[model samples]
Target: MKMLKEKIQKEGIVLSDTVLKVDTFLNHQIDPQLMQEIGKEFAARFKDAGITKIVTIESSGIAPALMTGLILDVPVIFARKRKSLTLSDNLLTATVYSFTKQESNDISVSKDMLHEEDVVLLIDDFLANGQALKGLNDLVKQSGAQVAGAGIVIEKGFQTGGKEIRANGLRVESLAIVESLVNGGVVFAEESVNK
Candidate 1:
């Protein structure tokens, strides 16, 4: 988590008074070493939760999800942002709204990927409005699977997303929580995963 904080300080951009852009190393262009460490940190944070499976929203969340799955030696299941014909005929699907993109994506997962006997841990790159997590959480509920918690790489503390999710009584852990973004600078929360 210390390394992630340092990377954000070095490369994360404050796009607006509320949005933190981490595309340089997180969304678009990836830093493999940073990603590996991120996976390790998630594993360490959620190690005691009895995680039988790892879940995430597609596109952006795939990297960290896969990494965490590898480190934890659990199966990774991602909710697809778009449905593909290639996806098996039998699947579980849910709709989630993206606050940043200002749109909704119907995410889908094959039926065989998850089971009622499993406990799920959800992971994502960012937590803004909690809508995405809501949808993924909905999917888990529909499958009759237990949700262990949610793992986030960066949380916009100014926004109510992370707070609302926590209010829902889910254990949510963020590696970095940004208190605010002002005049192209990032203000971090007093409490971080490092703390």
Candidate 2:
């Protein structure tokens, strides 16, 4: 996880008191090595959990999801934020409020993609307020799949989302947890555990 912390320290930008823009290596510019490392890390943590599928939201989650899928040797499925002409009407949905974007978007997946027999592992690039994870968890529940756990690339440790999700008794793993980003400096959680 030091790799992640180093990347944030070097390339992450602060847009506001609450927003950390990691567009350089995470959300925008490609970093295949880092992405593969994250995937391998998640795979190692949940390797024995019987995760039949890995679920993530659109855009930012795609890279890690595919990488994780390769590590797990299973399929990765992404929930589309918007429905295009090809999205069927029978898709399962959950509305997610993105605090960063300050907007509500519906995330959905085809019913055929996930089923009752699946054991799902959810992944995302960031976990702030837990809204996106909540929506994805809802989709997992609706499909009758057991949520094996969730793996996040970066978690805001000072935020309530990580605590709230952990309180719900689901396994949660974060590679790099930011305790604070005060005065243009990144502070990592001291006692953070990667697995």
Q: Across residues 46-103, which tens digit of lDDT does each residue of candidate 1 receive?
A: 8988899999987789899889999999999888888787987687878887767888
Q: Which runs of model 1 end up more than 4 angstroms from their true locations? A: 192-195
TM-score between model 2 and native: 0.96
How far is 67's C-alpha from truth in model 2 (Å)?
Answer: 0.5
Q: Residue by residue across 83-147, what tens digits does model 2's lDDT show?
A: 97987898989999987788999999999999999999999999988999999999889989999
TM-score computed on alpha carbons, candidate 1:
0.94
lDDT of model number 1? 0.86
Estimate candidate 2's alpha-carbon lDDT, on a 0 to 1 scale: 0.90
Clashing pairs in 2: none
Looking at model 1, residue 169 earns an lDDT score of 95
Clashes of each: 0, 0
